[model samples]
Target: MNLTLKIWRQKDANAKGGIVTYQLGGVEPDMSFLEMLDVLNQDLIDKGEEPVVFDHDCREGICGTCSLQINGEPHGPDRLITTCQLHMRMFKDGDTIVIEPFRAKAFPVIKDLIVDRSSFERIQQAGGYVSVNTSGNTQDANAILVPKDKADTAFDAATCIGCGACVAACKNASAMLFTSAKVSQLALLPQGEVEADRRVLAMVEQMDKEGFGNCTNTGACEIECPKGISLENIARMNREYLRASTK
Candidate 1:
């Protein structure tokens, strides 16, 4: 298939960026989106031109490193999939694909399609973990009897990959979906009960400090999330926050 790619290009964080168009041919329908980009890069390299830079770690979609905004949608037009998992078949022949990095104040563009999502790491560090007693008297995690429903919900919330698609999708670029998912993952579990209040407070505070906008219940984040993380997590987090604040 012949395709026209209008991709964003920026030399550095402070450099001015714009869309650069390139015509590509012979794109296989079965080729992953990143693989199509690889073909484009190889062609450019053969012609002594600089290749387009994009973020990608595990192309298997487990890692959310391949965050991108395609034609105004995070992770392209697909539902419940990351950029790396997107296929060339999603576009028709002679289509003009607009590819850009995920846009958010907290996710400043680095270069080309790569953005500094380290803000997410900072938020996670604020209180996304539980302290375990690793001394000689450590309790077995398997010994804890967790209710099946709560366990399922916790597992669902834990699937968030920190891709920032939630932020990008929000009109206000809110990180509430991602932040709430993190909080719910721990707040629902017995092991996480010890510091549940502190965890929610710290994470939420860090999320605000990172310049993320407030969530207005638009539900865009959950619609764009690759993991299908639910808005219910956000409600659960609000309840947790209220409970924590009251205590």
Candidate 2:
């Protein structure tokens, strides 16, 4: 298939950026979106031009590193898939595709189609880990009993991949869905019960300091999330925060 791509190109964080157009032919329907981009880059390199830079790793959709805003959608027009998992067949022959990096004040552009999502790592580092050590004092899994339902919910919340799709989808650039998922995952578990209150408070405080906006409950984040992380996690986080504050 022949296609036209309008991609945003930036040399660095301070460089002036703009949409640059390119035309390509022979885009196979079976090619993954990143594979198609690879073809484009090869062509550019062959022409003595710099290849387009985009983030990608573990293209199987686990790492959540391949993030691109395709035609105004977080991970293209797909329901629950990262940019690397997106296929060329999602577009028709002769389609004009606009590919851009995820945009948020906290996500600064690094180069063509690559944005610095280290903000997420910072927020995670703030309070996303369990405080307990399990080196030699690890307990048997069967020693503690956890309700099936609560365990299921906690597992669901733990599916978040920190892809920044939530922030890109939100009109407010809110990290609430991602941050709240991390909070809820631990808050719902017995092992996490020890520092639950402090965890929520610190994570939320760090999220705010990252310059992320407030969640307006537009529900865009859950809709675009590749893992299908629920909006319910946000509600759970709010409840946890309230309980923490009251204590």
Candidate 3:
């Protein structure tokens, strides 16, 4: 298949950027999106042209580093899919694909398709962890014996990969989904109980300090999230924040 790619190119965060066009020929329908990009970059390199730059790691979709806004949709038109997992077959021949980096003031564009998502790391550093002693191995997996329901919920919340798709897809660029997912995962587990209040407050404050926008319940973030992270997590975080604030 052939495709016309209109990709955003910027030298740096402060540099002026614009869409640069390139025509990709002979893209295999089954090729993963990043593989197609590799083909494109190879062609550009052969001609001594600067290759298109994009983020990718563990292309199987676990890393969440392959960030791209394709055809005006975060991670393309697919639901519950990362950019690396996106297949070229989703597009038809002669399609014009508009590619851009994940857009959010907090996530400044570094180059072609890469954005600095270290804001997430900073938020995590703020208090997204527990304080369990690890001097020795625990007794057994069944020792804690949390309710199955809570365990399941916590597992679901833990699936968040910090892709920043939630912020990019939000009208206000809210980091609520990402922050809440981290909170919910630990808050639901028995091990995360001791510092729950402090954790919520610290993470939320860090999120705000990162310049991320507020959540208005537009639900765009959940939809664009490659992991299907739910807005229910946002609601949970809100309740946690409210309770912490009152306390």
* Residues 122-225, model 1: lDDT tens digits: 99999999999888899988899999999999999999999899999999999999999999999999999999999999999999999999989999999999
Q: Estimate each model's TM-score.
A: 0.98, 0.98, 0.97
lDDT (Cα, tens digit) per residue for candidate 2, span 30-75: 9999999999999999999999999999999999898999999999
Please write out the lDDT profile of model 3 over residues 34-131, one tens digit for every residue.
Answer: 99999999999999999988999899889878889899888999999999999998999999999999899899988878899999999999999988
Candidate 2 stretches with Cα past 4 Å from truth are none
Candidate 1 is scored at a TM of 0.98
Candidate 1, 221: how far from true, in Å?
A: 0.9
Q: What lDDT score is found at residue 208 in candidate 1?
A: 96
Model 1 misplaced stretches (Cα beyond 4 Å): none
Instruction: Enumerate residue pairs that collide in model 1.
Output: none
Arranged by TM-score, best first: 1, 2, 3
- 144: Cα error in model 1, Å: 1.1
Global CA lDDT of candidate 2, please? 0.92
Error of 3 at 70 (Å): 0.5
Q: Give per-candidate clash totals.
A: 0, 0, 0
**Once superposed on the true structure, which residue ranges of model 3 sit more than 4 Å away at CA?**
137-141
* Candidate 3 accuracy as lDDT: 0.92
- Deviation from native of the Cα of residue 188 in model 2, angstroms: 0.7
